[model samples]
Target: MELLKVSGVNKAFGGLKALNDVNLTVNEGTVHAIIGPNGAGKSTLLNCFVGRLIPDTGTVMFADKSLIGLKAHQINQAGVSRVFQTPEIFGELSLLQNVMIPTMAKRDGEFALHAFKRLDKDAEIIDTALHSLEDVGLADKKDVIANSLSRGDKRRLELAMCLVQSPRLLLLDEPTAGMSRADTNNTIDLLKRIGEDHNITKVVIEHDMHVVFSLATTVSVLAQGTVICEGKPQDIKGDPRVQEAYLGGAHL
Candidate 1:
């Protein structure tokens, strides 16, 4: 089944066409990779999905519901979670406390239960947060300050934060960005585990070909604001259109 449907999407900044009649469909429980060189409007398309940007002319449907005008929190509540290119976490909070934020999140985007206050009322949230930490391989660091962790650990924490929300759709922007090869491979293993454990559908926007080929079940190559080719991993690897999109050549 199609989990997401984006049709006739277009975005422009002044005369610059960021997205031009772009269309994409993501199947449920599949890791769909959106790849391109820089300035191909991948970010803009992701923003549109999460309500950060409203397309000039298009319909983005999640489970057949129109998502064009929903607020970010509302979209999040509707089971769409985004992991930004850079990890975003509370620097002063402990790892466990940070993971609890999404679980304790009120509808209006506030924490109804304070981290220190109402411990009894927060028991369920706290337990879930701890479990999420364990799943992300950060259980031992639960009490450590968020800012003290390495960059890779920070990324894992952010993923844990998103996972606790139980999102049906996870949007990842360069999830392994700036990581050493070991860390990158670790991330691939982590994602593989998550896919096995959850019924989540993923749309990953990544520049790393290794990461894309390793994790993606399907790939869409975009250039000049349009998707020029899309297919399975091996198919995309040999496609002339896909090659030209990334290697500085004319659009297909």
Candidate 2:
């Protein structure tokens, strides 16, 4: 039931080796979190998964299908969606309209803005958007401009955008990076609800231990471009290698 796998992955920039001989496997329908210090190559491994970076020698597989040579749009079309560190949304559009855009995207990377459907069909699209909005707790603000939303709401809007695609695997990079405690906890609840409601597999790169422990079913700890340890929440907490990874460095 492994949904994604990375084996023998290596990445470097000039003289700096970001990832070295790394291997990982993510099971279906679980939140797998990758955590490490600032320079542990956590993001480097994420890029390998999403086609943003190709490793020097490795296999990146989603459902056993290779992803190394695919383009970003191609990766997205393959049912892998990513939520960036920042909220990526249209500031000028209403929340509903913003959600409508991705639902209108064709698999070939073109936006079918003018492919007007029948009235009933368009109405169905609207209903879909509304339901997605409700899923993210934004149904009441469907008509509000995206920019007017608070920081947490903006993040929720981004989640709604991704959900509209019905992605089988969702990758999140620091989903709670810049939120207050209440917002962060709320986002955790939202993600938990999302997992239960949608049955989506999630791969998250996170620095917040609270968020990681709250949502992750499995945790991988990386240090100096290699995974030093990996285990369940309780196991990772008491791991001496995990302790060493953060003892002399910055928090993760």
Candidate 3:
């Protein structure tokens, strides 16, 4: 079953086209990756799906609903969530509190004012936030200030916050951007577990080949504002065109 369908999507700035006639499909409950060199339109394509940029043409459909015209928050409400390259968290807030804000917003639809209130009155919300933290193996650090955590833990905390929303489609941009080898492996393990345990569909935009090959069941390569190739990871790994256009070039 297809969970996301994007067809003939085009976006341009002045004279340069960032994305041109791009079409992509993500099946339900699978990890699909979009990869390419630095200048590729990978991030632009993601922005289109999440409503950060409105496409010049074509349509984006998620769970059978048209997503082209919706605002970013409306897109989230429509069951799509995104994690950026940079971790977005409240540095002064406790890790659990960070997760609680989104969880409550998803449930009660107000995050700003409610975040200041004591969470002790909402036992269910607190429990849900704890469970989300546990899913990313950060339950013990729940009370720690977000800024004090290591870089990897901050990434994990961000993931935990996103999970608390229970989004159907999770969009991740450079999820493992900076981390030690051990932390990278741990993140890979967590993503694998999440993919198995939940029915969530993931679309990741990353430059790390190791990360891409490890988690992506299917891969798509973009170059110069267009999709160059797409298939299983193994197929993409060996494709001569991919090697010449991306890997074999001086860049990698």
Candidate 4:
């Protein structure tokens, strides 16, 4: 079943067209990757899905409902969660605390630091957060300050935050933007494990082909804001259009 469907999507900035009648479909329980060169409107398309930017003309359907005008939080509440390029975590808070915020928000529709003092007394939410941290291999550091974590751990922390929400669709924007090869590979394995454990569908916007090929079940090539080609990883690797979209036929 298709979880996300974008049809005739168009967006523009003044006279510059960002996405031009683009269309895409992501099936359920698959890691779908959108790859493109810089300025190809990959981020723009993602914004449309999350309600940061509404498409000038098109329909974005998520699980049979229109996501075109929903607020960011509303979309999040609708089971769509996003991990940004930069790890978005509370630097001053502990790993457990960072995870608990979303857990509270998902249940109560809002969260506040004032309520954090009650975390120790709230076993249910704390257990949920601890399980999320454990899933991301951060349970041992639950008491550590968020800012003190390494980039890889910080990214894992961010994933724990998202996982706490029990999102049905996870959108990852450059999940491994800055990391060593070891960390990158670790993240790949972690994502794979998460998919196997949760069976959640994922949409990844990436520039690194290695990450794309390693994690993506399906690949879509975006060039100048248009989807030029899409297929399985091996098929995309051999597509000439994908090669041309990279750096002038320089082997995709």
Q: lDDT: which candidate is best?
A: 4
Per-candidate TM equals 0.94, 0.93, 0.94, 0.95
lDDT (C-alpha) at residue 135 in model 4:
97
Model 2, residue pairs in steric clash: none
Candidate 1: tens digits of C-alpha lDDT, residues 104-141: 77222533444466754667888898999999999999
**Reference-based lDDT, residue 180, model 1:** 93
- Model 4 CA lDDT for position 206: 93
Evaluated at residue 197, the lDDT of candidate 3 is: 80
Error of 4 at 127 (Å): 0.5
- Cα lDDT of model 3 by residue, 1-252, tens digit: 999999999999999999989999999888999999887899999999988899999999898999988988888888888888988888999998999888987997633565576777889999999999999999998899999998888888998888889899999999888777777788889989987887689999988899999999999999878888999999999998898877565643
Local accuracy of candidate 4 as per-residue lDDT tens digits, 1-252: 999999999999999999999999999999999999998999999999999999999999999999988999999999999999999899999999999989988987844556446658989999999999999989999999999998888899999999889899999999989888888999999999999999999999998899999999999989998999999999999888877778793454
- lDDT by candidate, in order shown: 0.91, 0.89, 0.89, 0.93
Best TM-score goes to which candidate? 4
Give the per-residue lDDT digits (tens) of candidate 2, residues 13-56: 99999999998989999899999988899988999888889899
For all the candidates, what are their Cα RMSDs to the real structure? 2.4, 2.3, 2.0, 2.3
lDDT for 179 in candidate 4 is: 83
TM-score quality measure for candidate 4: 0.95
User: How many residue pairs clash (N, CA or C atoms closer than 3 angstroms) in each of the candidate models, in the order given?
Assistant: 0, 0, 0, 0
**Which residue runs of candidate 3 sit more than 4 Å off their true CA positions?**
110-118, 247-252
The C-alpha local distance difference test score for the whole of candidate 2 amounts to 0.89
Residue 114, model 1: lDDT of: 43
